[model samples]
Target chain A: MSATEGFLHGLQLAFTPELLLTALIAAFVGTLIGVLPGLGAVAGAAIALPLTFMFDPVVGLVLIAGIYVGAQYGGSTGSILLNIPGDSTAVVATFDGYPMAQKGRAGPALAITAIGAFIASTIGLVFIVYSSGFVASFAITFNAVDYFALTAGGLLILARISGGTLAQGLLPMILGVVIATVGMESTSSYPRYTFGNLDLTLGIHIAVLAVGIYGVSEILYLIEDKRQRASYKKIRIKDLVPSRSEIRQSWGPWGRGSILGFILGTLPMPSATISTFVSYRMEKGIARNKSQFGKGAVQGLAGPEAANNSAAIGSIVPVLVLGLPFSAVLALMISAMIVHGIQPGPLMMEQQPDLFWSVIGALAIANVMLLVLNIPMIGIWVRILQIPRYILIPVIVLVASMGVFSVSNNMVNLYLMLALGAVGYFLRKYNYSLASMLVGFVLGPLIEDNFVRGMRVSQGDPAYFLSSTFAVVIWSVVVLIVIGAAVRTLLKRRAQRRLLDSTAK
Target chain B: MTLEPRTEHEAEPGGENLETPPEEHVEGRRSGSVVFATLSLVLAVGYVWMAFDMPNGTSGDPGPGTWPRVTGIAWVGISVLALIESLKVVRTAPADLFPTGKSLKLVAFFSAATVAYVILLPILGAYIVSSVYMFYVIGLLRSKWDIRGGIYAVVFGVGASLIFIELLQVRLVAFPW
Candidate 1:
């Protein structure tokens, strides 16, 4: 089928009562999870995975897809209102978002975020519709060497760009690789580091790790700082409507962010978090009023939020086409699809074009649903902050623990979550980048697999790594990015020292 | 609560009305850095030891240990550099690094409660264990006991069970309460 015909068919299928209803429910649940701190979309999908067991596979896929998109929209709410990120991508939003709230422009900040996200998601959907086939065909030609280089390039850039000293970032990243090696070794069927525990042999599930690190660790931090629990001013509906000037200023950032997000999100990288940071930096560099950033600039809010939503849509391309997931959330989405017997790959496009297109259509519809549901409901979401922290914290804990436990129905998961929660806490305390670690862990097995395969194909000749043009190009980019990051960090530190010296004088 | 629009000058970036203070450029204390360095070093050593125990086939036909051993050696080098850098730093206690006395006690209580909640979950079931855990956590956070807290705990516990069990149909291992 032609792309146009498939899109129309998918749209027709998406509008049916059952699928529309599923999308609506998933949107609500996704937004709810995003609004709540520590309960991310990964948990929502894991919790919802079993709920989809009885439904048609397409409906199940759509439901989880809706939830992922909704969470991306809802994530900015906490960042704008409470200075707490609803998720990691929202961390960039909090830089300017919370300051806007303090200045009584919280409504405009949030409104711009919604508008930017909706616009970007639309463009991202279009990008996927047009470019996914191209990417898939390109992926078909990729040898193991290309895959190895691509994965290594992603890890290197991620290590360089993640906030903190290079050593701090690389430590968590290397630790993640170590953690990923815990289960049976893929080549020889030999267990690497089970340490005699049967449960360890199965390896740590992503849900368990995410919930423990992102969810439980957040709770510990909040508990450690009671000041973070203070309530904010209740939001009014009038506060949500953006002024003409604010909306006009946001358009440029929105466009740039959408393009940036789509390009980055389609690549073999952790798109959502990385796109937001990169978009914010780009906006800051290009802004007419550069000083406004990190001080409640609407461009700061608009760009990152747009990138985040666009990246959410762009991330689906690889999963739908190449069957590779670049981030933790995408990994869970793949699992959800697999459980429903829908194997996502190039063959999926050929075998079930309707299903593939419908997934895309569902995401587009979900983006619309998010805009409609979130704008008028901003006041309600902000009111969530008014709930007493004492009451709110425990409910969050209960939900998080239950969600993790439900994934495998094992007590070991709960314990593992609590243990990793402690590890995550200390990691955060010492300024290690958890996202980098997570990227390392998620991409570890794939990297090892591709490398070993490439080597075996070349009869253990290391020279084969540089044999392919794609490998050479990818490695070149990796080297350039790492060097660029190091130079930038040195310049920034020197500038800071000069400022300090001038102040002293 | 009415929010008044600030003066235009105050709203401008880098103006006096900034909501939060500029980030202070405080250097980290030696103790914290030392702690992190030591932790990394110890972990790297253990990892290298484990890697050595596994078979290391020739470079031509690598075994399970190849990737890990390379990572472990690099990790050791990095940690030692971190250790050396940490030794040159002076001591200072930032708020995030060191909690207040009251917060310390709360941290202890929170940790203990979490451990207890995990251990008692299967034995008592999600419904009972969650309620009691919620009740205790709320009491500590609020620094007092109240009927409202108990009510909140009950609602959350029952709500979780209903959603996870009856609605979502997740098969959790729980006592038949």
Candidate 2:
């Protein structure tokens, strides 16, 4: 279908009163969970996913997608107002967004983020419509080696951008790959790391770990490092909503961030999180008012916020076409699709156009609804922050532990949760990020199975990995990035030494 | 932290001696990192050997060991990274450990109650286990310290319990007794 037709069709279905109401509710709930420090979009999406099962798959997908979009937008709200970012992507926003709030420009900062996110999301949706077919066609050509290379390239960037040394990022990634190996090996009939325990042989659930890391451990972390018991002051509602100038200024970053975000997000790693950080850095490096960046540049807040929401939209291309989950939330969303006997791949658009179009419609509506709902309600959310940390954290911990344990009604899960929590707690202590580790855990099996399958076909010819044009292209990119990183570090050191020598002379 | 940070437990002269097993420094790194790494290593090694022993994966597929071997390799690789990290921090970084007394007490108290709730679920059914667990955990986290707060904690907890059991309708821990 044409882009205009797709846009009009999605708008027509989504604007219907009942669908709009359902989306608004989802947005509200998603925002609530996403605003909380310990909870994140993945948890918000997963917990809310099963609830949507009772609805028709189309409606269910819409509501679920709504929650997904809302959570991304809502996460920015917390970071912009309070310094505590709800998710990792939200961390970048806090650098300027919260600073703006402290400077009584909370209104403009929140305004840019809310409006920026809405505009970027729209641009991203347009890309998904125009490019999904192309990506799907391209994906049909992906073999194991090509897939492996792409995954590696995405992962390398993820590790490289997570701050600190290459060793720092690689360390967590390796740990994750190992952790994912704990359950059954996907290819071999034999179980790998179950340790003779039947429950564990099934392996640790990715969802549970997400909860423990983002939900449980974070609560524990916040409790330990209580950053001011209350918000500095209430942000005026007008400041939370974008003004005309804020909207006008948003155009440059919004357009650049969204388009760039869409491309970066189609990769296999933490696409949404990475795009946000990179977009923020780009805005700072290029903005005319560079000095205002961390001191509260609305453009800094706007660019990354837009990029992240747009990246969420960009992620759908891979999910819709290749069946490769671009992020963890997509993994669970794919799992949910599996439950409904719907396979996610290139044929899905043709197979289920109505479902496809309606969900897109729902997502577009969800973004608008979040901006509409959240801007006016900053006062209410600020009160939520005042709920007394002593009471709030434990309540969250109680609910999270309860919800997870209830799934199997097994204490084994509880023990696992606690065990994972303690593990999560320690991982944080040593500054090892939990995000990539989880990515490894989930993708390790898939990566291994595919790599081995490719090898056997080549009869142990390692060069077989370089066989296909797609595989070759992907691998070339991976190799270039790795080599580039190494060269960059060497050059940096030389530059530093030269500068030091000149100073001495 | 407020009081001059006393070492929680000094074991042997590892910190004092230059040749302490190196793990002595690392041992203080969160126990989770090591355990996860070990788990990954065992998984990777076992899978590689298993796939190696099997004939060319399953029918028309890569050998059974093929996938497992990669998994095992990744496991070993990642675990080695984590182990190195934990070791580096323990040896090189000045150690900062221990939760505040309040955090520790709450974690310990909640943990014990949860264990009890798990034990009681089969006998008590989903409702009672949830009610009991939620009520106690909420109280401990709050530090509310008043009868009115206690009543509110139980009441709000029950409200949550109702949402889980009635609204969501999933069977939580079914109490046995």
Candidate 3:
């Protein structure tokens, strides 16, 4: 189907009563998860995985997508209200948002955030509609070796970009690949790490691992912290309306941030976080009154908030076109698609145009729904913030456990989830990036499959992997990424040393 | 290129300056890194040893074990480098990272309770096990047992059971009887 035809079909699918209701509920749930401090988009997606299974693949995907968009909207709430970021991407919002709140302009900050997010997402959706087909057309030509290069390059880039030392990122990712090898090997049907357990043959479900790592681990961390409850003044509906000048001030930043965010979001990295930070820096750089930055500049809040939502929408492009997930949340979306027997690469556009277009349509619908839901429901979200940790903790744990169990009705998964949760906690405490690990796990099988296939086609010549021009280019990019990371680390260390020396003087 | 956006705050003109890590905290982090590196090295070695038993095909027709073997070897190298790096840093971590004794106790109690709940789930059924687990955990988290906690736990347990078992038709063992 043509792009226009597919999009129309998607719109038709999205408007169905059942799908609309699903999108609405997903938006509310997503926002709620985002408003909560510890529960991020990854955890929200993991918790909702089982419930999605009950719906058709299109509806299920829409639900997941809606939740993601909703979470993006909700993530700013905590940052604005309490200076605590709901997710890493929302961290930028806290720079200006909390200050605005301190100045009794909390309502305007939130109102502007919702408006910026809506506009940015709409802009991003337009880009996806126009650009995805072109990208997929190019991607369809990728051979096994090229695919191997792409996946390997993607993993290396992610590890290099994920915060902290390279080893800290790589070890967890390698561990994820090792975990992927636990079940039967696809080519030879040889079980690599089953260890005589029958259940091991079935392989670990991605949702189970996600729930364990993101959901269960977060719960443990929250329990360990023993943080005091956040107290914020009750916000009324009238308080949500931003001043006319505030809205006018947001326009320029929103346009610039949306464009920058869309461009950056297509890369194989933590696009939302990176885009928001870059947008903040750009806004601050261009602002006439720079002193207002950390003191509640309208541009600072508007730019990053726009970038956050745009980057989120932009991140979906690579997933849709190349069937490669650059982040953990996208990986979960891919997993959902795979579960429904829908292959996600370029061919999906042709074979499952309805599914493809509907997802895009649902995203648009969900973005619209988020605007309608978040503004009026700001008060409810503030109430969610007031929920006692004790109550929220048990509810999260129960939901995580139930979600894992419902995957295949296997008790073994529950045990695995608990075990992984403990491991996740330790790994997190040590500053290892769990997002890298998850992306590794999701992409591991594909890497192995492509590697083995390329080897077979070449009659076992390893050099065949580098024979293709595309493969060579990808490898070069990977090398450049590593070199770049090493240089950055050295510079940071030098800067730290200089600062320390000056302090001593 | 760097996604560590929080670090940008340090460069902000009027941003709150991030404090340098205290000596004790730095030492604690170093020690923690060393322990983690050691554990990772051990695990990597174990994985490599296991990979030895699997059949590795020729370069042209690599078998199922080839990927795992390569991954294991890479892991071993990374872990060794990490261990060396950790050893070079001179610092000592805290005896325990947990903030207070009570926080540690909460984690331990909750962990043990969860394990027990999972074990008893099949035998006692979802409703009973879930209700008891929720109540106990709620009280543990609040650091007090209360009637309201009990009531919420029961309601949650029953509500969850109904939704998953009856409404969704999930094949969970709902009742032992």
CAPRI classification of candidate 2: incorrect
By DockQ, is 1 or 3 better? 3
Best by the TM-score measure? 3
Q: Give the poorly placed runs of model 1, Cα more than 4 Å off.
A: A16-18, A37-65, A78-109, A228-249, A267-304, A323-325, A334-348, A351-355, A487-505, B1-28, B84-94, B166-171
- lDDT per residue for candidate 1 within A1-505, as digits (tens), equals 7777777778887888888888888888788878876556765565455455557888878887888888888988888877777767788888898888888898889889988989999999988888877777787788888878877677766665563555655777777777888888877988888898888877776667766766676677667654444466766778788889989889999999999998888765567877898999999999889888888888898998999889989988878987666665676676567657887777788888889988887777888888988898887777764566677667777767777777667788889889888887777666666666766776777788887787678888999999999899988887776666556755765676688789999
Q: Candidate 3: misplaced stretches above 4 Å?
A: A491-505, B1-20, B89-97
Give the per-residue lDDT of model 2 (tens digit) for A1-505.
Answer: 8656866787787887878888888788777776766567876665555455555666666776777777787787667666777777687888888877777777778778777888888899888878877776777677788777666555555544442434445656665665666666554556655667888777766556666655666666555553455444667765555667766767888888998788887775577887887898898888898887888777788788889988888887777776666576776666556546777777777777766677778888887888788788877766665566655654565566556665554557766766677677766665555556665565566676667777667777778777778767766765665556656755765676688789999
Please report how far candidate 2 places residue A243 from its true position, in Å: 5.5
TM-score of each: 0.85, 0.82, 0.94
Off by over 4 Å in 2: A7-22, A46-60, A152-204, A235-247, A405-412, A452-462, A482-505, B1-60, B81-100, B173-177
Ranking by lDDT: 3, 1, 2
What's the lDDT for residue B52 in model 3? 85
Q: Give the TM-score (vs. native) of candidate 3.
A: 0.94
**Considering summed lDDT, which 10 consecutive residues are worst modelled in model 3 chain A?**
A160-169
Classified by CAPRI criteria, candidate 1 counts as acceptable
Candidate 3: lDDT of B55? 88
Candidate 2 vs. true structure, TM-score: 0.82
Candidate 3 lDDT, B54-159, residue by residue in tens: 9898877888789999889989988886787666533223334544588888889988998998888888888998899989999998878899999989998878
Q: Identify the candidate with maximal lDDT.
A: 3
